[model samples]
Target chain A: MNNTLKKNDMKTAYIMLLPIVGLLTVFVVIPLLYAIFVSFYQWSFYQDSIFVGFSNYLLVLKDQAFYKAMWTGIKFALIVIPIQFVAAFLFAHLIKNLTAKVGGFVKTSIYIPHVISGVVASIVFMFIYNYNGGLANYIVSLFGSEPIPFLADVKYALGSISLPAIWLGFGFTTLIILAGINDIPDSYYEAAEIDGANTFHKMIFITLPLLKNVFLYVIVVGLTGAIQQFDLAYVMTNGGPLNSTMTPNLFIYTHFKNDPYMGYTISAALLLFVIIGVISALMFRLINSKQVED
Target chain B: MKKPKFLAFMLTVLFIISSILTGCSGTGPAGTEEEKPDDSSDSGKTVLNFWTPQWGDADKEWWEKNIEAYNKSQDKVEVKLEIVPGDAWDQKVVAAQAAGTSPDITTMNYNKIIFSAEQGKILPLDEYTDPAIWDDLYENIAEFVTLDGKHYAYPMLAEPSAVLFYRKDMFKEAGLDPEKAPVTWDELIEYGKKLKKGNVFGLAAAGNAAEYGWTHWGFQAMVGQQPISEDWSEATIVNEPTKELITFWNEMYQSGILPKQPLGGYTDIKPLAEGQVAMQINGSWAIGQLRNDYPDLLDNIGVAVVPTNDGNQDKPTASLGGWTLTIDGNSKHPKESAEFIQWLLAGDEQIMVDFFKDVTKFSKFTARKSVDEVLAQDSEGANDPWRKLIAEEVVPYAVAEPIYAWEVSMAYATALERVMLEGTDLEKSLQTAEKEINDYIKNNNYAGTNPKK
Candidate 1:
C-alpha cells in the first residue's frame, strides 16, 4: 500500500509538471535548438540557406564589434549591479524601520519607477540628459562648466544610459531586499543586542549573513538583466555618438536587420547567450561558495 | 524565519515594486508598437494584410480612414491595416517574410523595394497593373520603381532629402541677403559666420552618424552620385569631387559656426522653429511642420535648396525619397493587391491629391503627373509659395535616393562622423568605409545582383 501510495504521488507530481515542461520544450527548447541550427548555416531573410558549418561562429568570435559590445555589456552590468546593490540595501534597511503608514508611503513612492516602462523612463532621462537646455546642463552651468553631452558624447553615453536603468530597477531590488531582511527572525537581533550589539553591529552580523540567498538572487538577476539591456540603451543612445552604449542584445538586434547577416547575427546571439550563461554560473558559484564561512 | 515579519516585508516589497515598474509599458521610438495583424479572412472575401510605416498623425488617420473606405467599397477583397513603427518596420517586415507570415501589401520606398524585388520577394506590379497607370506617373519618379522593364512598386510621393530652411530675420539681422540663399559650399560658410552670435548657432545640419547617413545621399548627389560604381563592382566614395565635398563639410564643421552638439535630428526643424539656430538643413516637410506648429515663425522662415557643390543651382544637393506600394512575394492575393494599389494611388487623381493635402499643404511632391497638375491648380498647391519653390527649384534638381544596403551607407556615415566630429584623417575614414563595403559585397557575392539589371 505504501509503494502504491508513493507511485500515485509520483504520477500526480508528473501530471502537475507536464504543462510547464511541455511549455518549456515547445517555447524555449525548440527555439533554442532552431537558433543553433540556423547559426550553422548562411541563412538569410529572403535567400536560400547555404550550409556554412561553424565559420559563422569563428567569424563572430573574431569580429571586433562583437568584443566591443560584450565589453560594453559587462561594463554596464558592473556599473549597475554594485550601485543598485548598495542603494537597494541602504533604502530597504532604512525603510524597514519606519512606522507602517510612513513606510508604506515611502515604499510606494520608491516603487513608482519600477512600474514606469523602460521607454518612458528612457524618454524622461533623455530630456534630463539633453546636451543643452536640459536640467542636467542647467545644473552644470550653475557650477560654471560647459554642458556635458550626456547621451551624445561617447565619453558619457554608457553612464547616461545606465542612469535610467538604475532608476527603473532600483525599486524592485530594494523591495526584494527589504522582504529578505523582514524574513529574518527578531530573536537573532534580540540575542545580538543582549550580547552588546547595537543596531549597526546587529545589522552587520545578523542581517547581512542571513540574507545570503537573497543577495545571490538579486545579484545574479540584476547582473543578467543589466547586461541584456536593449530598449533603454536603444531609446537613449540608439548605440551611438559612438557605440559606447551598445549592449549585447542591441548589437545582435542591429545585425539581425541587415540582410544576409542572418547566420553571422545568430552566431553572435549564441555567443552572447553563452556569455550570459557563463556569467550567471560564475555568479551562482561565487555566491553559493561563500556559505557564510561559519 | 517569522511568518508575521515575512508577511510585513512582502507587503513593503510589493508596494516598492509598484513604483519601480513604471518602465514597463512605454515603447522606444523605434521599438515595436505592434497592432495585431488579421489572423484569418472574414466571411468569404479575400483578406489583404497591409502594413504601413508610422506616418505623421494626419497621414496615419488618412490611411486608416481610406483602408476602411476601401474595405467598405468592395466585397471581393478585405484590406486589414497594420501600422508598423517606422524604426522597426524594416526588421519586422523581413522577419515576417522569413517566418512566412508576410503582409499582402505594404508601403515601401522605391530604393529599398528594389532589393526585395531582386530577391523575388516582391511581385512586379506591371503584370497586374495597367500601362496607362504607369504613364500617368512622372518619368523621373516612375523610373526608380521600374527596373529591367518591370514596375515593382507604385509611387506615392517624393521629397528632397535636404532643403535649406533659414530664419529670414536672422539673415536680415546679420546683414546677409535673406532673398538669395547660399548657392555654393563656400557661400554657406561665409553666410554661417555672419549669422553666428552669442547663445545662437549659425547653422545646424546632421551632426551625428545616423542622421548624416541618411542626409549624406543628398550630399553625395551634390558632388556626383557614384557613391559606389555604376556596375556595382567597387566603392567610389573616395573620388575627388566626393573627397572635396567631405572636406568642405569638415571645414565648416571645424569652423565653430555650427553648434558642437545638434539640438535635434536632421529631419527635425524644432531647433529652427524654436529659434535655437539661425539656419537648418532639414527636409521640405519642415514647411508643413512650421506651418502647422509655428505659424508665427513661418513669415520669418526662408526655404531654399541646399547649396550645390559648385555654384551651379542645377546640381542636386538632395535625393528624392518617398513611399511606394509593394505586393509581397508570399501574398495570396496579388491581383487584388494590384487592384487596390491602382484604385487608391493611380486611378483617382483626387484621392492622391487629398493625400498630399492631408500631409500638410503639399510639403511632399506628387509622383503622378496628373495629380501634380490638379495640385498645380489648387489653392494650396500652385498658390502655396513654398510648394511652388520646392517643386520647381528643389524637385527638378534632386536625384533618386541610392538603393544600396543600409550597412554600406552606415559605414560611410560612421567614417564621415569620425572624420567630421573627431577630426580624423579623411583618407583613413574613406579607406575604412571602402574596405567595409568591399567586404560586405564580397561575402554576399553582390555582383550582377543589381535590381536595375
Candidate 2:
C-alpha cells in the first residue's frame, strides 16, 4: 500500500515537472538550437536559404562592426561591473549597519529604481543626460563646468548610457549583497572586536573574506547582464550618436532588420553567446575553486 | 490526511473545470455572434483584418472612429482594425507574416514596401487597384511606393517635408527680414550668424541619428543631384556635387551658426519653437503641431523651402517619407481589402478629408491630390495657405530615400556625421561611403534604376 502511494507521488511529481519541461523545450531549447542551425545557413526572409557551411560565422568573425560592437560590450561591462560592485557593496554595508526598521526603509528606497520599468528608467536618464536642459548639465553648470551633450557626443554617449544600467541594476545587487552581509554571523565580528581589530580591520579581514561567495554571485550575474544589455541601448539611443553605443545585442538587432544577412546576425549572436558563456564559466569555476581553497 | 488529500484532488478538478469554463466564457459572446456558422447570413460578411501603427492618442481615437464608420457602412464586409504600437509593430508584422497570420491589409514604411514586395509578402495593387488611382497620387511620392514599375502599395501621408521653419520674432530680434527665408546655403549661414544670441542658435538642422538628422532630411537638401547613379548601381557621393554638398554643411557647422548639441530626435523642433534657434529645417507636419501645441509661437513661425545650394535652387531639398497601405499577398480576402483601401484612401473624398482634418488634425500630409485639394479648402487648411504651397511646390521636389538598402543610406549619413561632429576628412569619409555602398549593392545584387546600355 505504501509502495503504491509512493508511485502515485512520483507520478504527480513528474506531471508537475511536465509543464516546465515542455515550456523550456518550446521557448528556450528549440529556439537556441534553431539559432545555432541558422548560423550555418545563408538565410533571408521569404528567400531561398543556402547551406553556407560556417561561411556566415567566418564573415561575422571578419566583420569590423562585429568586433567594434563586441569591444563596446566589453568596455561597457568593465565600466558597469567594478562601479556597481563597489557601490552595491558599500550601500549593503551601510544598510546592514542600520536598525531593522530603518534598514528596511532605506533598502526599499534604493530598490525603487529597480522596480521601475527599464524603458521608463531609460527615458528618465535621457532627460537627465539631455544637453539643452538636462539635470546633469544644470548641476554641472552650478559647478562652473560647460554644458555637455551626454548622449550626442561619441566620447560621452557610451558612458552616458552606462549610468542608467548602474542606476537600475545596483539596487537589486545591493539587496542581494545586503542579505549576504547580514547572513555573516555576529560572532565573527565579535571575535574580531575581542582580538583588538579596528572596525576597518574587521571589514577587511573578517567581513570581506566571508562575502566571497556573495561577490562571486554578484560578479557573474552582473557580468552576464551587462554583456547582454539591450533594452537600455534600444530605448535610450537606438545605438546611435554614430553607433558608438552599439553593443553586440544592438548589432544583432540591426542585422535582423536588414533581413538578407539574418544568418550573419545569428552567427554573431552565437559567437557572443559562446564568448560570454566561456568567460562566465571560467569566472564561476575560479570563484568556486577559491571558496574550496578557503 | 486522507481527507486533506481528497479535498486537494477535488479542488484540482474543480480548478481545471473552472479554467476551461472561463476560457469558453471569455470567447463565448463574440464566438456566438462572429464565429457562429449557424448564422449563414452573418457568416457571409467577409471580415478583413487591417493593421496600422498606433501613431498616438489623437491618431488612435481617430482610427477607432473611422474603423467603426467603415464597419457600419457595409454589411457585405467588416474591417477589423488593429492599432499596433509603433515599436512593436515591425516585430508583430514580421511574425504574423512568418506564421501566415498577417492582417489582410497593413500600413508599411515606404522603404519596406519595396523590400516586402520583393519578398512577395505584399500584393501588387496594380492588379486589383485602378490605374487612375495610382495616377492621381503625387508623381514623386508615387515613385517611392513603386518597385520595378509595379505598384506595391498606395502612397499615404507624407510628413512636413524638410521645409525651413523660421521664428519671425527671432529674425526681427536679429534685425533681419522676418518675412524672408534663406533662399540659398550662403544666405542661410549669413542669417544664422545674425540670429545667434546668448542662448539662441542661428540655425539648427538634424544633428542626431533620428529621421530629421544630417543623413535623412538634411542629406536630401544636400543631394544637389540624385546621390545615386541613374541606374542605382553606383554611389554618386564620390562626385563633385555630392562633395560640394557635404563641404557646405560642414562649413555651416564650423561657422558656429549650428548648435553644438545634436537635436534630440524626430519631432525635436523644440529649439526652434522655443526661440533657441532662429531657423530649423523640418517637415511640413510641424505646422499642425505648432498650431496645436505651441499656438503662442504659431504667429511667429513662417515656413519656406529648405535652402538649397545655388546650383540646385529649382530642385526641392526635402525628402518625402510616410506610411503606405499595402495588401498582404496571402490575405484570403483581397478584393474586400482593396475595396476598403479604395474607399478610405482614394474614392471617399469626405472620409479622406476627415482622416486629415478630424483624425490627423491636418498633421499628416495627404498623398492623394484630390484629398489635398479638399483639405486645402477646409477651414483649418484654408487659413494656412502654406498647405497648398507645400502640396504643389515642396512635395514635387522631395525625393524618397534610395530603396537599395538601409545601410546604403546610413553610409552617407555616417560620412556627414563624421565630418560635422568628429571633424573627419569629408572627402575621405565620403569616398569610403561610396565604396561601401557600391560594394553592398554588388554583394546583394540589388536592382535599382538599372543603367541603360
Candidate 3:
C-alpha cells in the first residue's frame, strides 16, 4: 500500500513539471539556440546573411576599438562594483540596526535613486557637472579650486560617468543587503555577546561570515549589470571626450541602433554573452565552493 | 481527482492555443472593414501621425500651436505630433522602420535622408511633385533632397553652421566696441583674449567629439578654401586649408583664451546663454533660443558673420544643418501625405515655418521662388535678425555634407571623432577611414563608387 502511494506521487510530480519544462524549451532554449546560430553568419539588414563561420569572431578580436571598449568596460565595472557594494552594505547595516521608523525613512531615501529613470538621472547629472555655473563647479569654487571638466576630459570622464551609475545602483543594492542581514537570527549575536565577543569581533566573525552569501550575490549581480551598462554612457557621454567611457554594449548598440549592421552587432553581442557567461559561471563556482568549505 | 486536474489544464492549454491561432488567422486592422471610419469625411476626425525630435520648451509650444492651427484649418486631418526625445529618436525611428510600422510623415536629417532613400525605405516625391516645385527651392537645398534624379524629401529648414555670437553688454563691460565684431581669425583671437576674465570665457567652441565637436565649427568655417570636387570623390580637399584650421584651433585651445584643457563645448549650452561666455561660435539655431529662452539677454546679445582668413573671403560658409519631411514608401496614405506635405510647404504656411524654426529663429528657404518676396516681407523686422540671416547669408553659403552609404558615413563620422578627440595623425586617420569607407562601399555597393566600379 505504501509503495503504491509512492508511485502515484511520483507520477503526479512529473505531470506538474511537464508544462514548465515545455515553456522553458519553447521560450528560452529555442531563442538562445537561434541567436547562437545567427551569430555565426555575416548578417546585413538589406541582404541574406551568408555563412561566415568564425570570421566574425576573428574580426572582433582584431578590431582595436573593440579591445579599447572592452578594457573600458572592465575598468568601469571594477571601479563601480566595490564602491557600490561597500556603500550599500554599510547603509544596509546601519538601517538594520536603526529603530524601525528611522530605518524605514533611511531606506526610502536611499531607494529613491533606484526608482529614478536612468535617462532622467543622466540629465540631472549633466546639469550638476556642467562646466560653468554647474553645482559641482560652484562647490569647487567655494574651495578656491579650478573647475574640473567632468564630462569633457578623457582623464576624468569615466570616473565622472561612474558616479551616476553608482548613485543609481547603491539604493537597490543596500535594500538587498539589508534584507539579507535582517534574515539572520538574533540568537547568534546573543550567544556571541554572552561569550564576551566584542562588537567588532561579533561583526567580523559572525555577521560578515553569515552575510557571505548575500555579498557574493551582490558582487556577481553588480558585475554583470555593470558589464552590460549602456543607458548611462549613451545619455551622458555617447562615448565622447575621446571615447574614454565607451563600453562594448554601447558599441554594439550604436551599430545596431543607428546603422543596421545586424551581423556584426550580433557577433559582438555573442562574444560579450560568452564572456559574461564564463565569468559568471566561474564566480558562482568559486563562491559556492567557498560556502561548502565553510 | 488527478484526471480532473489534468483535464482542466489541458482545457486551458487548448483555449490558449485556439486564441493564438485565431489571432494569427484574423485579418489585421489595416485589412479589416472595422478599421474604416463610419464617416470618412467627418470634420476633426482624421488621424495623422507626425514625428519630430525634441526641441526645447518654447519650440515645443510653438510647434503645438502651429500643429493646432493646421488641424483647425483642415476639416479632415487631425494631426497628432509626437515629439521623440533626442536620445531615443534615432533608435525609435530605426525600430519603427524595421517593424514596418512607421508614421506616415517623419523628419530626418539630410545625411539620413540619402541613406534611407538609397535603402528604398522612403518614397521618392519626384513622381508626386511637379518639377516646377523643384525650381522654387534654393538650388543647393533642392539638390540635397534629390538622389539618383529623384526627390526623396521636402526641405523643411536649413540651419547655417557656426557663427560668432557675442554679448554686447559684456563687450561694453569689458571695454570693447560691440558693432565691430571680429572679422578675421586673428582679430577673433585677439577679441577673445580681450574678453577673457575670472569667470567669463572669450569664446565657446564645442570641443566634445560626441557633439560633432570642432569639426562642425572649424571644418565648415574653412569650407570656402576646401570645396569638395564637383564630383564627390575623395578627401583631396583636406589639404593646406584644413591643416591651417586645425592649427588655428589648437593654438586657440593653448592660448587660455578658450576654456582650459579638456574643453567643455558640446553638451553645455547654458554657459553661453547664461552670459558665462562673452562670445560663442554656434549654429544659427542658437539665435532662436536666445530670443525665446533668454529674452532677458536680448539687448545684450549680437550676431556676426564668422571671421575668415582674410577680408577677401566673400561670405561665411556655414555648415548646412536641417531636416526634410518625407513620406514612407510603405505608408497607407501616400496621397494624403503628399498633399499634406504640399500644403505644409506652401507660402501660406510661413507660420508653420516660424513655429518649427530652431532657437536661431531661421526658417528653411522656400522651395518656391515665388515665395521669396513673401518670406522677406514676413521676416522684415529689427527683432528678427535670425530671419534676416537665414534669408540672406545662410541660405546662399550653406553646403551639404558629402553623402555616403549609411554604414560608410557613420564609419567616417566615427573616424572623424577619433581624429579630433585623440589627436590622431590626420593623414593616417583619413587614409584608414577612406580605406574602410571604400571597402564598406564596395561591399554594400553604395552609390558614387569611383573608377566606374
lDDT of 1 by residue, A1-294 (tens): 597787668667765765665566556765686789778877654555667889999878867788999999999999999998999999998999899999999999999999999999888887888766789888999999866778766678898888888988999999999999999999998888789999889877889888988999899899999999999988877788767888999999888876544777888988888989999998887877465333
* Candidate 3: tens digits of C-alpha lDDT, residues A1-294: 697797688678867976775576456654465567766776543334577787767767766777888888889999999999989888887888799999889889999999999899998998898777789989988999988778867778899889999999999999998888888899999998999999899889987888888888888899989988888888788886667888889988877785544556767888888888888887788777476446
- For B1-453, candidate 3 gives per-residue lDDT tens digits of 565776578657655654553343322212112122222334536566778888677667766877787778867777678998986798888766644467778988776777667655688876666676677787777777887788889887766666668889888987899777888888888988889888788888665554443235335445444323223444332456655655566567667666753334443445677777788877767766666667787787788777777743455556676777898756666666776776676436455445444423543344455555554465343246656655566556655754544444344445555555567776676566566655554444543542112
Off by over 4 Å in 1: A1-8, A44-48, A186-206, A290-294, B1-43, B72-74, B225-227, B239-242, B254-256
> Which regions of candidate 2 are displaced past 4 Å?
A1-18, A42-48, A192-201, A290-294, B1-44, B56-58, B210-222, B225-234, B357-365, B372-383, B446-453
Please, what are the lDDT tens digits per residue for candidate 2 over residues B1-453?
A: 554675567557545654453343321111111231121236677788889998667677777887788888878888877888888887787666544567788998876777678766788877777778987887877877777788888876886457788999888878888988888888988898888876677887777654423236445545655555666778877777777777887887777687666545545577788777888877666776676678777788888878778735467576777887898866766777887887777787787787677655565687788887787677777775677667666777666655655676677778777887798887898888888777767755664644221
DockQ of 1: 0.18
Which one wins on lDDT?
1
Question: Could you tell me which 10 consecutive residues in candidate 1 chain B have the lowest summed lDDT?
Answer: B26-35
Error of 3 at A4 (Å): 7.8
Worst 10 residues of 2 chain A by lDDT: A41-50
Off by over 4 Å in 3: A1-61, A95-101, A186-205, A289-294, B1-48, B56-80, B213-239, B260-269, B347-364, B378-386, B405-453
